[model samples]
Target: MAHSTDNVILQGAHGTFAKQLVFRQRFGQSILCKRPKKSNLSPTDAQLSVRARFLAASVYAKSVRANPELLVLLVKGLQ
Candidate 1:
């Protein structure tokens, strides 16, 4: 089983592709949805890195909401 943080990191790296894989592996194929192709929106790599971190943090927050125990452990580790 993957830690919630791992899922968030993967999501940050691959976007919907990582999301689909994580959901399918953890929850099953029923959650998988067809992802539309992205349109061209240019951003520098630095900007993309920032975006990825923001996205991962958002996903991590949601996961923490869903599983408070896991969140507690994560918090404890950070401390």
Candidate 2:
């Protein structure tokens, strides 16, 4: 990791560049670092199950939001 306090173009610049470097602004300073390599590991059975559950919940939430009556009920319950 490297820190940059100068450089006009990179003063407030951020995000990945050239798919190799990562630039971010932190604590009023510019930071530069190498991009991490992608992981090639496969998800375990438990992870897959959790992901399936999350997908099902997301779909249900979207459906509920699409229905105005359900949305009103949800908001009332939140209170």
Candidate 1 lDDT over 42-75, as tens digits, reads 9999999999999999998898978989988888
Please give each candidate's TM-score: 0.37, 0.78
Q: What is the lDDT of every predicted structure here?
A: 0.64, 0.90
lDDT of 2 by residue, 1-79 (tens): 5544568998888999999999887888888889989899999999999999999999999999999999999999999
Candidate 2: where is the Cα deviation over 4 Å?
A: 1-3
Best by the lDDT measure = 2
Off by over 4 Å in 1: 1-42
Best by TM-score: 2
**Model 2, backbone clash pairs (residues 3+ apart or across chains), number:** 0
Model 1's C-alpha root-mean-square deviation from the true structure amounts to 16.1
- Least well predicted 10-residue stretch by lDDT in candidate 1: 22-31
